[model samples]
Target: MKTSLKSAKRLFVALIFVALGSCSIAHSGDGHSLKVTASAYNSVKSQAHGNPSIGAWGDHLKPGMKVIAVSRDLIKMGLKHNTRVKIDGLPGTYLVKDKMGKRWSRKIDIYMGTDVKAARRWGKRTVIIRW
Candidate 1:
């Protein structure tokens, strides 16, 4: 009985691992995409997640802002590594830039649950800049 119980527990654990692994795989290569809400903006923190946003962090942003990248897989999209890229996360809209740097303004806003490390690695690398 003890051996059979242990076997069942191992099988259950294996199944859970497989399920979790599959989910992460599905999310792999897939990231939340944002848009350029304003038309012309001064500049931006290339990689950021939330609050006191990119705009508040800087000066000279406007509607119809020009953008620099499509996704975080920027290097894959031919973006030079460490180049300053920008995107707008409009509160209630979703916009994704196409490969050639054109905004396909969307009605839904995509939110990236970004972290400090991600922002630092991707956005402005200044040590004093807080998220």
Candidate 2:
């Protein structure tokens, strides 16, 4: 009876570990993750200074594109233009279509097309991202 009890306890512990591992994996997406501050912006704001390029990649900004702008530091951290990333707490995948200024670091800017109000509403927040 004691041997059976020990085996049951071992099984229970193993199950708990498996459950925890699954949760971590689910949260980390493909297992590559980073935490950074995120904000929202639109083309108008981005081009206010007469910059002609829609993005660093030269792609035109459009609604429903699911794209993101990463800081230069993030680009050095492997978030190159056109890389796909998944933002925690936000549904859907986002593509890295733009690059932020040199002064920014560990930050992401979500593109909201021409919706200035929506961009303003999003503001800024710390978010986890996975690639």
Candidate 3:
């Protein structure tokens, strides 16, 4: 009876470990979730330069990609360059392509290709982001 009880305990412990390991594996490739404030920007020549300097990825911003500039602090929190993120209210996912300046914290800048008016309209708002 004592040997059987020990065996049952061991089996229970092993099952718990398997469950937790599976949960972590399921969430691994899918980036973690975070809530953040977001704004928009455009590359129009009139308002500001149309081109961004070399990003953390060591390349210029691609025109058509759904990309966002994340705050420096967020980068420290694992939202690093090339990380894919999903905006809660938005329809599609975005990539972390650039890093914001030190003055900004907990903010994300959505890149709207050459659409100055759209960027201005987007403005700023609190939104849920999954990275």
Candidate 4:
């Protein structure tokens, strides 16, 4: 009977672990995956720097865009550029993190914009940028 009880406890713990794993993987997706390459943020930086060729860049941000609000606090929490994360939308931020975040600059901001309501969705994130 003790062995059976132990097995049940182990099974319960395993089930909880699996549930939490699935929940993490099921991060918020504004009805789309919005696979944006790192180049997008790079473009923003260059454009902000008066890059003439920036005009030919992709369309500006729209609503429904998943906003990855990578802020100074995110850095404090260990977030870095090019770091991928699964986070829920808080109407102005995302819980992003990275491994090499401790050794990075603190003047860069990253945002994502999809063809959908990218701006609105992005607005829900902390990475605020004009479209």
Q: Per model, how many backbone clashes are there? A: 13, 0, 1, 16
For residues 1-131, write the lDDT of model 3, one tens digit per residue.
99999999999999999987754212336656666889987655554433454454565765576989899988987888888888887888898887777899889999887777788899889887886
Local error of candidate 3 at 19, Å? 28
Q: Which is the better candidate, 3 or 4, if ranked by TM-score?
A: 3
Q: Which candidate leads the pack in lDDT?
A: 2
- TM-score, per-candidate, Cα-based: 0.23, 0.73, 0.68, 0.27
Model 2, span 1-131: residue lDDT tens: 99999999999999999987764223343657878999987878555445533788788878778999999988876889889899989899999999888899889999888888999999999999898
For candidate 4, lDDT tens digit of each residue in 1-131?
Answer: 99999999999999999987654112233321222212123224433445421222222333334333343433443344434444323244332321112333222223443322333343322221211
Q: CA lDDT of 33 in candidate 2?
A: 85
Model 1: per-residue lDDT, tens digit, 1-131? 99999999999999999987654111223332322222221223553333223432232323343323233343343333223332333222223332223233221122233344433344431111000
lDDT of each: 0.33, 0.84, 0.77, 0.36
lDDT of 4 at 91: 46
Error of 3 at 99 (Å): 0.7
Superposed by TM-score, candidate 1 places the C-alpha of residue 103 at a distance from the truth, in angstroms, of 30
- Alpha carbon lDDT at 90, candidate 2: 87
Evaluated against the true structure, the overall lDDT of model 3 is: 0.77
* Number of colliding residue pairs in model 4: 16
